[model samples]
Target: MNIIQQKKDERTRVVYIHIPFCTNKCFYCDFNSYVLKDQPVMDYLRALDREMEMTVQAQPPGSISSIFVGGGTPTVLKPDEMQFFLNSVRKHFPDWDENIEFSMEANPGTTDLEKLSVMREGGVNRVSFGVQAFQNELLSGIGRIHNTDDVYRSLENARAAGFQNMSIDLMFGLPNQTVDMLSESVTKALELGLPHYSIYSLKVEENTLFHTMYQKNQLPLPDEEDELNMYLLLMNRMSEAGYRQYEISNFSKPGYESRHNMAYWLNEDYYGLGAGAHGYIGRQRHVNVKGVNPYIEAVNQGLPRLNTLDIPREEAMEDFLMVGLRVLDGISRARFEQQFGASMDQTFAAPLEKLVHAGLLDTTDEGYKLSSKGILFGNDVFGEFIGSLTGN
Candidate 1:
């Protein structure tokens, strides 16, 4: 690449750390993970530290705005281990923004007051708990290790640990979940009065136990109508609870939106490290080796890169729109024009016009956003962007 292109790429400032260990894999989970019993936890952390060193060596960045350590279950680490991991991060990425949002995903069953205290001391300002459901039976049915009590306790511990900016995740349309159950989960989560919520409809992914049961017709998930009711109910309830529906599945109490996730939706550059982590710097997109041993060995050698691709401008613009429109505010026309040097209207004329005609999209004063109808069919709207970009 030329000097000008390289200079533009230097704006990369976000960092993602992956901790690929869980107590036990959930039935619906398909993320890179392994059972935590007898795993080399310390060794993995050292490997991650090495990976971070290699990453900065490859491309030294300016001040980082955010760092998200996602899992397996990050809270699985002991208090001291958590401290070591976070400290290693600060040591490597020393020029972090003062207001940097350092978030870590925690599972309810394992996150305790002591561990959270250590995390707080280590500069973890935000916590996202994976409380998939509020009902114990449903939680067990879905292979979640934590119960409702665990969820409450985890939230309390997080709050006591000085985490005011917190987010809880809930899943709907589970094997035996109904609209009423979904509402109950939302109601319980709202009662906690956290800053943000992410309620997702369960999708049966391949290689997961859920997919196996689904293929055998053993799973009794909510029908399309019931799932639709669940979505509508949660939206209304969240709105009444004074939370804004910022994204299709995410809600936040004013100004509590996730800056790290927003970086992805805004289509900005970021650094990704650890096993199975993905990074996008400039036009090149890359994923580290998904296997833990392979990642450790590769990083020790030089870098842990698995595969890389250079995305075309048209494809990148479509990805930007697809992710940005998931937010209620939607993408900006001026930003799109500036990034791609092409007007959004002129570039995506046919699909935008067709979707708006079908009442699936509404044009705001500044740009286009998904209509209420479009949300239920968000995948379809995003599908248009992808198809239009690749001519598929």
Candidate 2:
């Protein structure tokens, strides 16, 4: 089951393009990214173009429904740089759906009106700003470069650039983040009247500065009780404010869910381009080289792959349960049967029965979904299915 390679299936409808450069790295960040100073910005963009060309040639694309450009601070690209990068995207995967979700991650202060106009003109209709927190103290404590003002100004700039579909990300469980602080942040975020919000808890990942602080007992994270309270508070707040908790950490108004992210939660295949990007196609998943120069060099010769693993059926079936349950709609029984050629209940009867008996999962006419109780303890519910089939 380890590192098995498999053929790619048809219909990969998503695209995740990565830009691994930022002005400064956040303390809690562990994504494959680099500081932008002295970096080869243009060279990386050109390499990404080459990769796009090679990737589509290999798999061939159908009409793209979603294209997401993620960080480190994609908005940091200069106007000309942004234009060139967008040109490359259009040059390669040009068959876009009429209602395609062309989203880009932007930092607050980095996106001036000029740059945002370029992005809008370049076919980016949705822009998600990374406004991690509202408090200046909290922002600075987490190594964020923008202040509270930047969030407002950036959103204003985005709207002015003709973007009506917008989103913002906020973080909780940050160092010294009180529940009151989180409440205040939520109040301010809702005031903006944005369509979507992704509020996530902080996980101190390895290779992050926060991890070192945690090891030395210096990271002042909220206690588990407060963190839970914070989560409950936001869920209540968003629900009261007419936002649906469609996924564990995401809330959106009706008809405004992030379609690009839904592709991931639905466990669909996508094209991953650029440095350190990951792509899953057919039953195979591939990751590109991490370093900026290394990715460029690899793309010059061939697909910039660090490794491509073939997902075994048992693992893939388990994956079907793990990620699919994150959505409130849960995994579709018919979808599981369609993908694996077996009945969902018959295949995962043991774990399904256990979870349903525990009241963590409620059986639906269509399939199964997390109960109200289960949503809070989602990790526990998801864990039960890990080794149910293969016992590995």
Compared with the true structure, all predictions reach lDDT values of 0.89, 0.93
TM-score of each: 0.96, 0.97
Clashes of each: 0, 3
Q: Please, what are the lDDT tens digits per residue for candidate 1 over residues 1-392?
A: 99975774466789988999999999999999988888888988999998888788888877888999998898899989999998999889888788899999999978889999999999899999999888899989989888888888888888899999899999888888888888888888888889899998899999999899999999998899998899999999999999999899999998889899999988988998889999998878999899877877887888888999999887898898899899889888998987888899988999999999999999998899999999889999988888687775
Q: Which residue runs does candidate 1 get wrong by more than 4 Å? A: 1-10
Residue pairs whose backbone atoms clash in candidate 2: 4-310, 8-282, 9-282
> Which lDDT value does model 1 have at 354?
95
Residue by residue across 324-347, what tens digits does model 2's lDDT show?
899998889999888889898998
Q: Best-fitting candidate, measured by TM-score?
A: 2
lDDT of 2 at 65: 94
